[model samples]
Target: MSTPAPHAAPLVLVTGASGYIGGRLVPALLDAGFRVRAMARHADRLQDRPWRDRVEVVEADVQDPASLEAALDGVDVAYYLIHAMGGGRSFADRDRQGARSFADASARAGVGRIVYLGGIHPDGEELSTHMASRKEVGDILLAGAVPAVVLRAAVILGSGSASFEIMRHLAERLPVMIAPQWLRNRIQPIAVRDVLHYLVGAARLDGAPNRTFDVGGPDVLTFAELLQAYARAAGLPQRRILTVPVLTPRLASHWIGLVTPVPTGIARPLVESLIHESVAAEADLRALIPAPEGGLTSVDRAIELALARVRELDVATAWHSATPAGAPSSPLPEDPEWSGGIVRGDERQRPVDASPETLWAVLEGIGGRRGWYSWRLGWISRGLMDRLVGGPGLRRGRRHPDKLAVGDALDWWRVERLERGRLLRLRAEMRVPGQAWLELGVQEADDGGSILHQRAIYHPHGLLGDLYWWAVWPFHEIVFGGMQRNIARAAEAAPPDSRRAVNTDTDTDTDTEETA
Candidate 1:
């Protein structure tokens, strides 16, 4: 018998590869024997993905027609997952323009098909800006020369999804709630896994016509019932929801922003979409593509899977996966004078009687339940203030207690860069007047020991930012100074066998969940 010869796999271009859905879809496409080209506006944003090296990455913005044309070249299928919700008030216009550019470019590139994931909305009813834009984008794609499959979904339930995050935080933080009347509006929520399954399956629908298909889970329930279901799945007490006719969508979004990591800009659109019922009107997609192995996921099962991922620290992507458009992305300059801005820093260094490996171990395990090395009360106070102002605060916590990768959220700080056993740089997600970063590094010393270096870097925005830095500088001695000293002391005090034990436990400790 002759062995079959391998052939080139069909190439699929995934825009918005840095987002929650696109990030997870890349690995799924690869598993399904498709060649994936992960496209992002900034290619470096995808550098830290676990499958970064597996897929070909292209830097392209959908609004930039030239870049889209180049990115869509030689693509059998293109996934339109990009949206401009974080771009401010003109987001709908931007979404419209981007869809037009992408549709034209895909046709010029001779792409086989286009797959789009859009929000499920009722027909013949006035839609929110978010849902209307989604529907328009789908329409633009379906009208193009290339065949398109638009899978419309309601609330996508997953650990790191925005909808799931909003629901989780509301249920966890509020035992009794004064909510909007939209809580009674019916919705057919779908699991993120099911959405991804349908998306991947769309690629193989060779002769399917270009049209929209409604996709949803096995259960249909109201927002109130969903919250109650989430509480039950998370092992929490029953929640009392008091719906008031006075609470408007804008007010509800602000309330959500204050409690969850999601901000008002993104939350408002989501809130508006929930003002009406969003039950799926048709299940035509299931006829073309079969459901996953066990059939559609139930609401309870989806919540369980999401909670399990959070507990196990195995979330693949988060709503925060994409950096905010206005947030600082530049690296810390070597010299403050060269930055062309006022840069204030709190720097501390300490010599330790421990190996570099031991110091790295302590540094990697700094946040989450382990807590900051010093000034716990001060940190808590600041975190609470941030939360009140619609910030991530400290509740987001580190993804893993013992190990961290770049982009992992660590108590309102994001891991910006990681050089194994050498350097770890964290960018702040907390609400502040300006941008901030905390960098921790370890190096070998001449005395057969390690030297720990810690720095808190801040770039002020205006007069207020500068004043804020000066106000906080007085406490740096207790905060930054003690943090460095305590970290060094921890490395020195740790047992010689603890370094290996930490690494081993990262793989074996799947059941132990860390608290804020």
Candidate 2:
């Protein structure tokens, strides 16, 4: 079965709708004319998705079978993208049990087809706990009466994808590396675009039930080659990777956790999977879905596109958003006046020629992918320094590029306060010696324009913290001064306040503030 026979959009239910693949998949399915129901345990987290309004969101937990009935009711096809990768050491058992419950419930609901995304099996080699669990879950789905369609793939290349993030950090941070042995092992990788094509195409197939197909990009390369390719795509010099057998998977996983944002639980399984070759033995997936317009994406091309998306801050959803456990609430409660300590500060106030509404719009759109609206090189340097010291750096971009929620993580800062079109306060989370905050205030001026108030407040911990603040004072003026001026200019250059059309980058801003 190649092309799906024509029919009205099926009532499709996608579990783990907030995950990296699932979050991106929802839009693709909608474009293909399918009516989609996105199911996630925490429905609030999915509110930032660009397509959030397009799909129907239902709250469901795999562990609690009772909650899945509504999602399964009247569903024609279900996408089982949920897994326990981040649920700690007991993930395997939980994944297996969850699969059984889902399968049984699907049967009871009279669901027609189950489309599962699983990893390609290692040829005649032992599997890691996560990989083995994936295999077992697929079997569990097929064991039920429903016709299950499984599409197995290896490393998925896309912005905010875990595998690409690991490779990205390795390539960007390390100029030369003492690489693990797995770097020499060969593996097949696939582009997310192609993977979605197959998943959506599978649903249209008139009758390809109970089938398993292998999917991968056209290229088959080693882990070393993949890392080097990413570096080249990012315009860096070809990296030096010296393979060392002494670095075991455990050591490598911990090292990855340090250099990159990937947690030990998720990185460990991926590293363990790298222990075995993951080349797709079968290429029957092409028959099911026609190749993309440009054909399959080569490794270098895939990495290029993925990084471009990151730079543009156009990522749809992140792997971390898959499970929001222990995440800090956005728009944290305001602190007292003496909060982080106002021992010393840099204050800049400018009267913008634009309306208050226009100025605030520019202020609200700061950070995330927009950079600092001033010196990006300095911001990148600070982020890199933070990463080296085991901080989040700027990896966790805003959940939505154009929107900011109360609890959203914005680059190396957290949204401490958001007052819609009036003000935004961001508290620093980088490895600073003490507490710090950046506040932007906009209010209508008596002259019918707007006054922009910018302040940087810091509370030093001790001698070291005080010294750290003064040490960066000279650099701070350059960054902060340029920031206030540029923001004012952007607002001035944009259309009138009522239109809300503003330039994020404009060169005509003039500084009307007294330098302090």
Candidate 3:
């Protein structure tokens, strides 16, 4: 493949662009005045991102050499943020293979630099499978022909980070608990903002050698102390934690899986990594790349900022953004009728005594603290069931109270499509036997009012999926029917001024009323 024409700014390729770090890094690189090309296995996943229009998006998989080579073409720097943490027992081997492919592709493309984010591990000690895999990937990149910068960090504290979410839920849910012995292991956590700072700076380095750099925040604390700090930041009472020796990482992972929204597959590796101290061994990188403005974020301040972002409904990217619920090739509801397999749906339309704008406002603000505008008990029961089965459940919540962007998480649903004042389509993230979506729309009626349309679409996998659909088919009335009625009622009752204030822009709107 031929290289694309160069821009005034250096072109940067960000692999895993839909992932937490990659998603956040793209905008940061753009803000730093670099032309960015975002690569993902499914380019459609990047379509909904707010920065989708600004960056060049290419569908590429690291495991595919040709795809990697094509993606790295015309790239000055490439950020390798891909990982296979939850891909079962062969994850490490897969990681190694992908890293090797990426390295070879970068060298062939003549990419100047490759920046990789890896976990921090104690030197000369046996590391957990997770940490070992990270180190191996870093080693592969550094040993390659291209100059690479490997940044090793531990416990990235952010609103939607896996580590932060695990800590947050544990601190909030269990005031008194029997914890694992590793809770007392010392760790040097860094804020996601600082990690981004160093990442952006690494791209501009004049002649940095290919080496691994340990990056961490100022404070060093044990996991127990970190939990206490989290409790303090969240205004919770001091937690009573009793450490016991019998609880192994495997056992603790199951316990954490039940307590937090993080699944056992991803939690096991994290729990194992916590068994070792992860304090930075050196600060050599500081001499090359300067610290962020002010200084390295303190632990307390990091926790506070993360909590504030959650409360204010301003989380930029979530841990699950990288792994969207359904398959990318799955046919959308809007696709041609003859496109996909056995599809089932529950469709409802109601003429409302409200304007299209009023109905749209109610539709936009359906999830999060506003509730589902339907059977409250049923929604809660279903969310709980989903949680028990290791799904996101309803805890993910919406990013904003009044307005939603396309990729925003609304409870167990992801905002797949959004048309301001017209339609909102949500894809189910809750664990189910089949792929599903919920769509809400507003249309002007002939009688100077509005018409509300609601749909629940599901695409079954096999006999099990078909059976699952029929089993829940009986409750459609109580769930879907009630939702339709309640949403129309909410639109009719909304204040006139409140209906006019619905803004679809991603900016925080101070004028909008805080919906409950």
Candidate 3 global lDDT: 0.83
List of clashing residue pairs for candidate 1: none
Candidate 3 Cα outliers beyond 4 Å, as residue runs: 1-7, 42-53, 324-329, 333-340, 497-516
Per model, state how many residue pairs clash.
0, 6, 0
Who is ahead in TM-score, 2 or 3? 3
Relative to the unseen true structure, what is the C-alpha lDDT of residue 346 in candidate 1, on a scale of 0 to 100? 82
Q: What TM-score does prediction 2 earn?
A: 0.71
What lDDT is reached at residue 408 by model 2? Answer: 55
List all candidate RMSDs to the true structure. 4.6, 8.1, 4.6
- The global C-alpha lDDT for each of the candidates, from Candidate 1 onward, is 0.83, 0.78, 0.83
For residues 1-516, write the lDDT of model 2, one tens digit per residue.
123347856878899887778878899999989989999876765665678888889999888899989889888899999878745567778898889999999988988899999998875677888899889999899888899998999999988788988899888889999988778988999998889989888888777479778999999999999998998899999999998888888788878866676655567788988888889989876776789887999888889888888777676656655653323332322346555543667889999999988888787766654666777677777877776654656656666655675445676676666787787888777778877878999989999999999988777778999999999998987789988888888888878874343445532222100000
Q: Can you write out model 3's per-residue Cα lDDT over 23-127, one digit (the tens) per residue?
A: 999999999999999998878667868899999999998877888777888888999998886666788888999999999999999999999999889999999
Sorted by TM-score (best first), the order is 1, 3, 2
What is the RMSD, in Å, between candidate 1 and the native fold over all Cα? 4.6
Q: Point out the worst 10-residue segment of candidate 1 by lDDT.
A: 503-512
